[model samples]
Target: MKKQILTTPDGESYPILTGTGLLETCGQEIAALTAPCRAMIVSDSNVAPLYLEKVVNSLKLAGFEVHTHVVSPGENSKSIAVFGALLESFAEAHLTRTDIAVALGGGVIGDLTGFAAGCYLRGIRFVQIPTTLLSAVDASVGGKTAINLQHGKNLAGMFHQPAAVYCDINTLKSLTPHELADGAAEAIKTGILGDPELFAIYETGDPENDAEEIISRAVAYKSKIVTEDPQEHGVRKLLNLGHTAAHAIELLSNFAISHGHAVAIGTAIVTRAAVKRGIMKNDEGTRIINTLKRNHLPTDSAFTAKELSKIATLDKKAAAKDITVIIPETIGRCRMEKIPISALEGLFADGLGEQV
Candidate 1:
């Protein structure tokens, strides 16, 4: 397994392990970090039947009293009701501060389980066992855990770091091509924000053949940023590169559009706008759009610029009058720009190549 340690400035740290078959050893890996106490393995309906038993057996062997809680699979599960149900499961399982919660599915499972673990008993440790490529490269590393609110996605959440993260690449083999593309969007976003080498892989190489390297590099880049600005007070905001418009797209679609696909559209839109405003070169913008398209990610949305901008104004990133948008100056470099809410529509118009 390829391993990297993310150590925050406050001295909090966790290990992110990426490789094939890591799931089978997940319990021992987590055990090395925290004692093998009661573990509530939270998964989704889709993943439970496939790998839950393997994890449960491993944890049991490691001396952890294992319990399982499975929810329906999809973005809809990242709701207040699901979160409440998870917390109740924690309570029913008698999990304490010392016990750990294990998230054994995709990003939704990670976010839902991590948030519930953070809230139950005031706060408790959680371990991330990401089964999908998106969660492996993104959600599994960052301490940010949240549930979608009626108002928007991830409006209610906290930064509760996991004790450990086990990314078993083997699990990705079970994903559909579209699901893999969903993850490619985030990896592409990561490459554009930082890591030109990673960006090149997407442009000219096959990601399926380099999954371990991709996950490790993405995790390392994010770890460096998160370690520097754990609370997102500064550099960490760069991670939201395409998320502003992406969240708006998600909310507009009632999450019919998955997060990664929305981000693919959002990144394309932002890059298009940057090119229009001369903030980025036309060649770079074209490269980004082409790469997303090549990866089977959508670069255009069904929503209009006006609709997206209006919903984006209500985003959590918005302040009283302005919202911070991450604009790419070039691949491997991005800057956060705070624009007034009134100008958001114009920005979207530029991105859509419509008359502003």
Candidate 2:
């Protein structure tokens, strides 16, 4: 198994174990941690039948008293109601702070379970067994846990780091093409943020055969940023590169669009806006759009600027008068620009690569 240790800005550290067939070793890994005698496996309905039993058996063999909770799959499942229910499950199971929570699915499960762990008894240790490429490369390592609201995406969230993360490449085999594409969008985003070499791979490499290396590189990139700024108080905000507009796009569509698709469109819009402002060249914008298109991601939205602007105000990244918008300086670099909230509508209109 390949291992990477993530160190927080405060010097705290956790290990990310990446390799094929690491699910069977989850129990042993947990035992190597603080050794909680009790654990709760939080998974989604789509993943429960496939690998939940294997994880449970592994935990049991390692002498852990295990309880399980399976949530319905999809973005909708990451809700306050679901989060509340998971807390209730923890209470009913008599989980104490010493007990741990194991998130055994994709990005949704990791976010929901991590939020549950953070709030359960004011906070408890949680492990991330990210089954999706997106979670492994981005969401699982950040300590940013969130649930969506009716008004916008990730309106309610907290920063609670996991005790450990086990990225079992074996899980990728079961994912649908859409799932893989969804994750590739994030990896591409990481490449665009830094590491031009990584960006080159996304443009020309076969992701299926190179999943492990690509995921590891992305994780390492994010880990370095998180180490420098664990919170979004500074450099970390750059990680929101395509997310500002992406959240608005997701909300305006009532989440009919998946996050990866939304991000693709968001990045394209931001790139175009940068081009219009002469911040990024026209060729750079074309490269970003082509990359997204080549990856089977979307670069267009049907919503008008007025509709998306209203949703943008509710984004967690937005402040009372300004929203921190991330723009690409070039394909492999980006910068944060705090735009006045009043100008958001215009930015959205301009970002569409058309006249308002």
TM-score of each: 0.98, 0.97
Query: Relative to the true structure, how large is the alpha-carbon lDDT of every model?
Result: 0.91, 0.87
Model 1 per-residue lDDT tens digits across residues 1-356: 89899999989988888998787888788888787789999999999999999999889888899999999999989899999988998999988889999999999999999899999989999999999999998988879999988888898999999988999999999999988998999999999999999999899998989999999989999999999999999899899888888998988888888889999999999999999999999999999999999999999978888999999988888999988889999999998998899998898888888896
> Which numbered prediction scores highest in TM-score against the true structure?
1
lDDT, candidate 2, equals: 0.87
Off by more than 4 A, model 2: none
For model 2, the run of ten residues with the poorest summed lDDT: 347-356
lDDT of 2 by residue, 16-50 (tens): 98897778988988999966488999999989999
Candidate 1: which pairs clash? none
lDDT of 2 at 90: 99
Candidate 2: residue pairs that collide:
none
